[model samples]
Target: MAKGKVGKTVESLGDYLREQRVASRLSLRQLAELAGVSNPYLSQIERGLRKPSAEVLQQIAKALRISAEQLYIRAGILSPDDGVGGSVELAILGDTGLTERQKQSLLDVYASFLALNAVSDAEFAADGDVAAEPVATDPPADTQDQDPQKITTEG
Candidate 1:
């Protein structure tokens, strides 16, 4: 594969994953077992010689007991989503283990965290302008009122 910005990002992701694994005190073989991937494959991923797919990143994140969205961001599978934590919100909503109440609680906390960060970001901006950048509160143009299963093609 051509080594470019994406390649560099994947390499950084590998470094990040290795750091997380070391911080969790799990050996490479142990992490590989937990992630249900072969040791050599995981080693190649950690060494930045291979770019893992989103599914692999999810598995590794689950094994690491961390947010899959975090790994997704590191892997460049998804952008920051205007810093609103939209992907994280979706992941939390899609989680089968969390009850409705639990999901609501988590969403509440996540929203509060975002609000706090927005305030801090505003404070650091010139003249503490909260509206420095227009917030993207709307859904993407392509997805607005569209069915998830349906595909639209423009000729």
Candidate 2:
């Protein structure tokens, strides 16, 4: 990405973070304390003077009771498409009942399923059947010439 675009993304992320903090009714110092960061650092982040790391974003998201993926996307750390199954991941991560090992196992299985589906979709597209099939977007040429009143319903 261009330097200008990166700067804008960081600035937007900071704006978003500040909005969330305000919406959550938390003071800057309170949010900084909750996120385990210094007050000055949080202020710098809110002002778009600093681009925080993924870990810091995660901490801030947790403190704000929001999805970390949203922050990651705003921070340009992850693309929107990359967060396709984010809700599932978030659910697994947020489940306090599950042990760390169980969460990891579930995440691994989910990732494998997504990977397998992606490969299957790619293979299907590459098989030439897609190109050979007619796209059913428009009526057939014969149907286009037919009168609607003359058409019979089999049902």
Candidate 3:
């Protein structure tokens, strides 16, 4: 990614974090405490002065009760396409210059799509066809070491 995009992503993530913090009614100090980061660092993030790694963003997401991918999208680390939609959100993120807030709103609303799936995760995993698949096991290797030269055609 270009430096400009990186800068924008950092600023956008910071902005989104600040918005989420406010929306959750969490003070900077409180959010920092929950995210396991320092208050000053959180402030720096909100001010776009520092770029956080995916792990840090995930921690912040956990603190905010949102998916880590959401934070990743805002951070410009992972594209929004990586969201649950599998590629749908990517197109939306691309081909349109939607603001981070708008994108986040769309993602939040889209998250409800889980309710529309034909089968729940447990049900899908329990399908008969899926259950019929063979399970792999580690096989014992031949422990004997034979000399290649000694293996000549011995009648």
Candidate 4:
């Protein structure tokens, strides 16, 4: 990405983080306490004076009760169409009733379901005729047509 674009993304991420924090009714000191970061550091993050690491973002997201993926997208670590559906994930993350563990569990289950469906789709595509072919462990290299802009994330 261009330098200008990156700067804009960082600013946008800062704005988004501030909005989430305010929406959760968390003050800077309270959020910093919850996220295990210094009050000044959290304030710097909200002011776009600092670019937080993935780990810090995760902590902040947990404190805000939002998805880290949302933060990742806002930070330009992942694009809009990177892998998951933003809206669905955001909805799950935004649900105040669900605990952090519950949200993570739900996301894991949802991701597993999507992965299984991908495998099934690949198998069906491989077997032109319906003859109950065995599923392959590895998908074809060209499976899903391969997006060059796709961002890969490691657990």
Candidate number of the best lDDT:
2
User: Compared with the true structure, what per-residue lDDT tens digits does model 2 show for residues 71-139?
Assistant: 977876555664564777667666779876786688778778878999998999888556656656767
Compute each candidate's TM-score over C-alphas. 0.54, 0.54, 0.51, 0.52
Residue 28: error of model 2 in Å? 0.6
Q: What TM-score does candidate 1 reach?
A: 0.54
Clashing residue pairs in candidate 1, if any?
none
The 10-residue segment with the lowest total lDDT in model 4: 77-86
- The segments of candidate 3 whose C-alpha lies over 4 angstroms from its true place after superposition are 1-3, 82-155
Question: How far out, in Å, is residue 39 in model 4?
Answer: 0.8
Off by over 4 Å in 1: 88-155
Which regions of candidate 4 fall more than 4 Å away from where they truly are?
Answer: 1-3, 84-155
Backbone clash pairs in model 4 (N, Cα, C under 3 Å; residues 3+ apart or in different chains), count? 0
**Where does the lowest 10-residue lDDT sum fall in candidate 1?**
126-135
Report the Cα lDDT for candidate 4.
0.79
Assess candidate 2 and give its TM-score to the true structure.
0.54
| C-alpha lDDT score of every prediction, in listed order | 0.81, 0.83, 0.74, 0.79
